[model samples]
Target: MTKAMLLLKFAGLEFSEDRGGYHKAPKGKLPFIDDEGLMVADSTSSVFT
Candidate 1:
């Protein structure tokens, strides 16, 4: 999770830490992106997108 945060920070993207909200993410995972309305799950997928 820390690594994801750091990468996002390096990318200069603004995001909020959703504490205790893993259940709301796709695949019930952490470090997902709710970009405009698109959902990208996990760091690898996000980077590619």
Candidate 2:
């Protein structure tokens, strides 16, 4: 979660932080964002998948 926020900051992108938990997350995964109403789930394990 912190890593995602930091990446957004470092990239100079303006983003709103949502504190909703796993149940409200995309596919029940953590650290995500709604880009043009698309639920993008950011997971490090995706590389392994």
Candidate 3:
């Protein structure tokens, strides 16, 4: 997941390396995102959204 974060960072996007699950999220999960003005969960769903 860190690699994925790095990739986004290289792309000039501000992403957070918080793959340690969130209270609003499920357990044993993590999220990568580009939190500039809004939170963008960098996942497969992103393609569809």
**What is the lDDT for 39 in model 1?**
83
List model 1 lDDT by residue over 1-49, tens digit each.
6777888899898878878778778878776778878888877777777
**What does candidate 3's lDDT look like per residue over 1-49, in tens digits?**
5555656666786644554557534332456444444544555544345
TM-score of 2: 0.64
After TM-score superposition, the amount by which residue 19's alpha carbon in candidate 2 deviates from its true location, in angstroms, is 1.1
Q: Estimate each model's TM-score.
A: 0.71, 0.64, 0.37
- Tell me how candidate 2 scores on lDDT: 0.68
Most accurate candidate by TM-score: 1
Indicate the residue-level lDDT of 39 in model 2: 70
lDDT-best of 1 and 3? 1
Question: Model 2 segments beyond 4 Å from truth?
Answer: 43-49
Candidate 3, overall lDDT?
0.51
Query: What is the RMSD of candidate 3?
Result: 4.1
Best by lDDT: 1
Ranking by lDDT: 1, 2, 3
